[model samples]
Target: MRAINAIRMGGVDVLPLVEGGKGVSISNGLSAGNWALAGGVGTFSAVNADSFDVNGRAIPQVYHGRTRRERHEELVSYAIQGALTQARRAWEVTGGKGRIHANILWEMGAAERIITEVLEQAKGLIHGITCGAGMPYRLSDIAARFNVYYYPIISSARAFNALWKRAYSKTAELLGGVVYEDPWLAGGHNGLSNGEDPLRPEDPLPRVMALRKVMRDFGLHETPIIMAGGVWCLEEWESWIDNPDLGPVAFQFGTRPLLTQESPIGNAWKQRLLTLKEGDVFLNRFSPTGFYSSAVSNGFLAELRERSERQVAFTTETIGEHVAEYGVGPRKRIVYLTYADRERALAWERQGFTDALRTPDSTLIFVTPEKAREILEDQTACMGCLSSCRFSNWAQHEPDYTNGKKADPRSFCIQKTLQDIAHESDEPAAVERNLMFSGHNAYRFGKDPFYSSGFIPTVKQLMERLLTGR
Candidate 1:
């Protein structure tokens, strides 16, 4: 393997391997700091990261607000403080050595506010900002205001072109890098556009070359393109390095870092990664943010799949082939379904899915009475985590503060599940019941000899391993 060399990113020379940021305290200061200490870019997630008390113990994010709006405000406050705390920790670990970037989701509730406050408070501690999950046109402006670099995470060349033409061109100097996150294989929320098919995985080389071409068109030839998603080892990506067509490129490891010693995920969650198979990580489109996401095919996902499977389309007015009347909810509101669908619904009800819940897509999904109650409770308890949520129909801004759509039963509250999975004690049951995000290459953990006997490497050790191309 060719020797790994330091590359310039965020106006600093460092190893091209960047630590990908995970959310809900999974990628905390320890992991980010250690990665930075290893002479690589360290990114701590600002998406609802945890803040600690005086003794450094994590304070539980228990919401006492009476209204969803009030809870949302509290959440934003928590997010800002948490980001600051993590930034400080990362800076401390780095000792003014490596680059530190804060990662945020553009669609997250009060995203602009959180990032603005974090940059204002963090100052020189954070060197860059990496954002994705939406077209964050305003990201460059915020980063420029703070005198930090901005890395916009995108899956296609068109996304970068749109960003460059709109807001990024103005702050071209501080445009640190562009993160090319593979939509079909990347973990967590994906940027899969309507034109793309999730079932068909495309080669990263062609797409990245296209992105490089677009970047060059905007006079961004020198800016590094951070390759993220499905990146396990440097050996497989040897050809990508020093490839003139792609220009300066860096590798971002999202899933591999989860098994590291400093990763903040619970032990049960870490252990589960070692036993995964090729098809265990599923690219699903069930996010409340209305974006495609990749997660483990665990019990939580299985339940969602089952609920969606029990769904039947309905119409208010009877049309051809949709003439069967069905009563939904306690009020017995009438909706028309097909004869075959009615029979399917009856069969599901007989199988203990007695309650029928209406979705935003003019569909009714059958679920257990207990599950129906749980879904309502989760929706009622929504604190507007996302800018707009399909599960609870909660929108952060404007007149009514609602998306003006019926709550979809097929999706669940992401904030609640992430916090649950991240903070829960080392218990397999709790870990399995919540969302577990992973890249498609997570199966490599079991197959790789480096992870034999479930040996979790430190960030420095992993860097050493990557350097040897093992």
Candidate 2:
């Protein structure tokens, strides 16, 4: 396979390939740098990125403070430092060929602040920024200040158009491209909206064309649409190449990139990825962030599925206002429920549904005590760096979402577990406790002769295989 020519992305000639940013430690500076070195775009995840250490040893960042605002500030500061560190590391690894991009979630309370500080601190090292998980109307403006290109990951043309109409218009000049991340197949948080039914998956071609039409409508015909999620070997997607229906197209790889040698993920996680089988990927709303995500149906995810199955909607007000004793306390006793729900819950418990427990915020329900205990221990063993977690409500500093409330138990403390997994910590004892994001096609590795060791390839090798179709 001949090497593909570089495409213009945010004013830089970059390989069409993009390293989709994975949070925690999935796609950090090392991985992104390698991607850029390979002549592709690398997106370093700045969300909960590690900032510093006490004596050159990495420090755990937990918001032990008293208020939400205080906790948010600490998180913002740490992210800023983390972003800078990752950028410099990437620059060193890439030797300056690849453009380093930062990926951030849009809904962070201090998103704008963190981004500003990151770009300011990273300076020229960071060349572009990619944001998703929510409509990032302000992304263009944020990227503009640094003269960096901006890419907004979206699932549909309608969502893109809405952003353009409401806020992105002003930053259109600096808009590098749009990332059409396939909601159903991509790892991490999906962009699926309430109006969109999960069961009804729309065809990608039509949606791509619609996006192209929107670009044309906005006079952005020259802008490329970076197709993400479910993209494997080009052989599987040759029909879309140079096809007018999906104009100015480029493909982005999320899960596929993890197999690369240069990928920043831990070796164990990578090995786990190689063994996945078809139909093993699942999409569910297990993230405390309140977003639906796609991941492997491993022990962790299976438990969540089981817990959901046991769920029977219960109301606070009984038939008219009936109070029920759901837990052992007054607070638990105050819960209202219908007879049917009570019967169903009791039945589920009798049938072994005793694993259910409240989320950290107490607003949602999760698996029973066994798993909840596992998750809590996982939380307490904090490597510490999520902005606001539901599991432990552990912030980086004090005054955390302290609203005088404990972190919701419904939401797992992402910082604690992800850091542990990334660092290969043995404290958790169970890899299945954390969510593992992967694509639906992650099973391809098992059949590939090149991956016999379960030895994951470096980013360079992975990119070569992708570009060469071998």
Candidate 3:
């Protein structure tokens, strides 16, 4: 195999490798800093990252606000402080070597404010900004204001073209790269559009080529296209390296780094990765952001599946074949359901799923009394983490501050579950009970010989191994 060479990215020559950012402090200063230390671009997630106190201990992000809007303010403040700290740490670790990029979900609450504040406070520390999870049209403007490069993560060439023509064209100089995150292979909040079939994943090579062509049409020929998701080894992607048709290219690893020593995930999460089989990672639409995500097929996902399965359409007034009267909630509000559906609901009730919660689509999902209470409590404690959440119906707009829809019980509170999974300890079931986002190729962890006997590598060691085309 040919030796891997450094590529110019964000105005710096670093190995054509990037650590895909994980949120809720999953990818933090320590991990991203070490990744930069290894001569690769390190991307630390600014989405509610953890801030440390003077004693070097993480400060718990507790909300003391009375309303969701108030708590949203607190969340934004916390995120800015955390992002600044992570940027500083990553810059320090580079030692005048690689580059550090801050990643943020555009759908995150007050994303523009948080990124602007972090960049204003930590100027010269962060070299670039990587943003996705939404259109993120304002990202280039923000990066240009800060004199930093911006990388927009998109799954399709058409999406990139739309962004380039609309907003990115203005700040074309600051556009560092375009990240092509495969919707099917990537973990956590996939970009699968309405036209694409989730079950039928298309080849990433063709998709990336199409993206490169669009970039070329926009006169962005040299901008590297970062191929993210399902990129485990460099050997498998040798054809993508130095390919003339694709132009400058880089590989992003979202799952392989979870077992590294610098990774912040718990030991149980790492152990679970090693035991996963080929089909263990499941792709489902359970996120409050209304985006499809990939996660481990654990107890948490199973419960969500069961909840959606026990659903039935209903109406308050009589309609065709909807004459079966059913009472829901403590008030016993009567709704009409189909006779066959009523029997199914009754059967679910016999199995202890007696609480029927209404969804935004006029459907009711049955759950146990305890489960219903927990769900309500979780919704009540909403901090407005996302700009628009289906679970809590929390929208970050003026006046009503709601999504103008009924709070859907089918989707769980993402803020609560993500925070719990990222930092939870001592609880034995936390790993299996919270969302464990992983790429479709996460099962390779069990088969990879380099990780035999559970030998986790440091970020530097992982970089070295990757450079060897393994």
Candidate 4:
């Protein structure tokens, strides 16, 4: 294995390994700070990070506002406070040892305001900002305002090209290394575009090389490319070391860091990672952000799959091959469906999926009455977590504050599920019932000898093991 060396990144020399930021308090100050102290870049999630009370207990993010817009304001305030708290903690723990970066989802509600507030309050504590989950065209400007570096996480070279052309070109100096997150392998919200097929996973080497080529074309030769997703041991990536074509490169580990002692995830969630098997992680398009994400194939995901499977398209009136008329909801709204689809819908209804919920599209999905009620309640209690949510049809805009479409039944409230899973109690079953984001290589936790007998490592130990190439 090639010897790991320190690289200059974010205006400092540090180890090439990076801790990928996980949200909803999974990757907090302790984990990120420890990784930074280990001479690597540590990225703490600033997307609604947990803030503590006077007694050092986590303060639950509760909203008292009745309207979605008001609740969104509350959420932004909480986010800013939480990010500042985490940044202060990370700075204290790192003791000015290495770089500390904050991660934010661009699709998050009031992203610019939250980031600006945090940076203003926590100035100098956070060295860089890493953003993903959408086209962050304004990220560079925001980072430059604070004189900090910005890393835009992109899945393809084309995405970076668009970002550079549209906005990043103005603030080229603050363009910290670009992060090429593998859409097929990364956890949480993925960047799989309409052109890509999720089933066929491509090799990261070629894709990353393509990204490097794009960077070189833009005269970004000295800038490093951070390779995230599906990265495990350094030995496997020995060939990428000192490769002139790829230039300075680094690796970001998201799933591997979850089992570390410093990780903020609950004990049940940590233990669950060691029991996963091959194909246990699934990539599905169920996020309210309208993007594909990878998560554990638990009961939560299974229920969503089943709900989508019971769907049937409908027409307002009788059309060709849509002769059967069906009544949905208590009002008995009439719609036309194909004869075969009518039979399927009837069968689903007879099997206890009595309530039919309309989606944003011209389709109806069947679910149990209880499930339908739960979905309605969740939608009603929407706090506008995302910039535009497909599940609740809540947009951050002031005038309308709606997506101008019906709320989608196939998707659930992501904010609620992520918070529940991350802060769930000791019950493993309850934790499994919530969305558990994980990378495709999460099964390796069970297979790797390093974690044999359910042994978990500290952040420093994991970094050492990774540097040794196993």
Candidate 5:
């Protein structure tokens, strides 16, 4: 018999383990379906998940557009189709065994429209919706309308309380448990605010207890708090289970599950995780969307790190002050800069970092010509998907950018690299250039005896080990 400690989520007695939704194809139908098949919760990322191809093979389109609105519409349509298809796939894989959920980022321009259309269409297939990357204030209303459970992925108790007071309280019936994704350690975008210190890592138990307190105060004492991010072995979490303060807790693994046999990440990516060491992941605000993200320390991340490290406070005095040019066009102009910076850049260029890529509307600097050519090719082969990309400011009309500013190459086109890392044939280049997400405990993969058999466990195997103690 299943353990009596099972938590109820979305009206289903679900194993607390959730396959945290990863964007850009990290968590897809196959991975989520297997999670649900194991009687745990599965959440497929619907942020422009691959829909289909002419031959019906799933193909993700991250940057296929000539205009902002066009990219936005494609993202919506693709999400709707992908969500439905993935949910149905999960149902098929699990034989109707476990609960299936969909994950959506709240910051997308058409986040509301895409999500509503997806849940409305998926109907009985999708049991719940999990939203994060921003406080999803409208999540309650949207989920309630579809008669589906809604879970807001939050980092702190304060954020949850604020949401409950304003919107979620009225729809308490469908308010699914809150997901406590660790802000400092988790891969992808973090939720840490400006005042939050990343250096001093705090224990999650107290924070979860605080969340439980909020639940009790809001008449939701029974609501489970799904703990995410750095969670690893269940044995380590035994103290949390049935604890008076935490009450009805469940652990969600974001990085641990990636090593499972059933996880859909590319083999090269998996191998990279096994070899990753401490201090290899970095959190930086390099994204054009102005979000802080975590990525593995690879050649790509190293280059960005070097650039950020070598940054000099530059100023322009004349047109020739910082003169650098790329393609000849109406928008072409040399970026002005200080004499000292110009000399420093020239010296660096002589040191073999010769290629210079242009920020969409800003100035041009040096990159290896090869990297520049690759960036240009990738941009030219664009499939507009983001609302507006900083790499290619190819908007539908005159003003292609959102802030009405030019695109910035300092921030690489995120959609392009993520798509490459997820599915491209160039495995090494993908790992080298794109960011790879993993948990803080990812090193355990190399140290754990359980994985010593040269075989990774499947989702079902991992869950069984966790719940049944191997």
Candidate 6:
């Protein structure tokens, strides 16, 4: 195995290993700080991070606002305070050892405002900002304003080129690095574009090389390209090390860190990771952000798959093969469906999935009455977590504050599920019911002999093991 060497990143020399930030308190201060203390870059998730009370107890984020707009304001306030708290905690643990970066989603609600507030309050503690889930063209500007390095996460060379040409070129000196997250392999929200197929996984070498070419064209030869997703053993990536084609490279691990002792996830979640098979992790486009994400194919995901599978197209006026008439909702609004589809829909309705919810694509999905009520309640209680949500039809814009479409029932509230999963006690039931974001390589925990006895390593131990290319 090639010896791991320190590299200059974020204006400092450190090991080119980064702990990828997971949101909703999955990767907290302790985990990230410990990684930084191990002489590597640590990224704490700033997206709805947790805050503590005076007694050092976790403060529950219970919303009391009646309107979605008011709740969104409350959420933003909580997020800023939480980010500051996490940043302070991480800084205290780091002891000024290595670089500390704050991670945020570009498509998150009030992303710019939340990031600005966090940076303002926790100025010196955070050395860099890493953003993903969208084309964060304004990230460079934000980092420049705060005088910190910026890393924009992209999946393709085209995305990086677009950001560079539009805004990144102006803040060239502050360009710390470019994170090329593998869309098909990464956890959480993926950056897979419309042109890309999720079923087909591409080799990262060619993609990273293309990204390096783009960076070199922009006079950023020295800047490192942080490779994220599908990265497990460094021994396998020995060829990538010191390769001139992809200069100054780093690896970001998101799933591997979740098994560490400092990981904020519950014990049940940790145990679940050790038992997963290769095909357990699934990549799907069920996210409210309208982006592809990878997660465990648990009962939660299976339910969504079933709901989508039971869907059929409908039209207001009969046309072509849409000859059968069907009624939807309490109003019994007439819609046309095919004779075969009508029979299928009737079968589903008889099976207690009587409520047919219309989707944005002119399709009706059947759900149980109880599930329908829960979906409505969740939508009603939306605090606008995302910039725009397909499930709740909530947009951050002020005038309308709506996506101008019916709330799709196929998707659920991400903020609600993440908060529940993160804060829930060490219970398998709770963990299995929510979205469990994980990288495709997560199944390796079961196959790896190191964790055969269900042994969970601390952040330091994990870093040491990774450094040895084990």
Per-residue alpha-carbon lDDT of model 6 for 1-470, expressed as tens digits?
Answer: 89999999988899999999999888888888999999899999999999999999889988999999999999999899999988998989988665799999999999999999899988799999999988899998899999999999999999999999999999999999999999999999998989988898999899999999989998999999999999998998888888988899999999999998899888889999999999999999999999999999998899999999999999999899998999998999999999999999999989999999999899999999998899999999999999999999999997999998889899999999999889883899987799999999999999998787999999999999999997
- Residues 140-216, candidate 3: write the lDDT tens digits: 88998889999999999999999999999999988889999999999888999999999999999989988988889
Give the per-residue lDDT digits (tens) of candidate 5, residues 94-181.
7777688898888655678888988777788788899988878999999989999999999899999999998999999998889998
List where candidate 3 sits over 4 angstroms from the true fold.
425-427
lDDT of each: 0.92, 0.73, 0.91, 0.92, 0.73, 0.93
Off by over 4 Å in 6: none
Local distance difference test, candidate 3: 0.91
lDDT of 4 by residue, 140-175 (tens): 999999999999999999999999999999999999
Taking every candidate in turn, the Cα RMSD to the unseen true structure, in Å, is 1.0, 4.0, 1.1, 1.0, 4.0, 0.9
Model 2 lDDT tens row, 1-470:
34466777789777788888887767888889988887888888888776556664555666664544555567667778877878888999988767888999886546778889888877888888899988888898888888988999999999999999998898898889999988877878888889888777777878888889998999998899999988887777777766766777788888787777676566667667777788788888877666888877777777666665555444445557344545422245455555666676677668654544543332334355666677666555533334444445554445443323464544565655566666662333445666677777788788777788676778888888788755
What TM-score would you give candidate 2 relative to the actual structure? 0.86
TM-score of each: 0.98, 0.86, 0.98, 0.98, 0.87, 0.99
Worst 10 residues of 1 by lDDT: 423-432
What range of 10 consecutive residues in model 3 has the weakest lDDT sum? 419-428
List residue ranges in candidate 4 displaced over 4 A. Answer: none
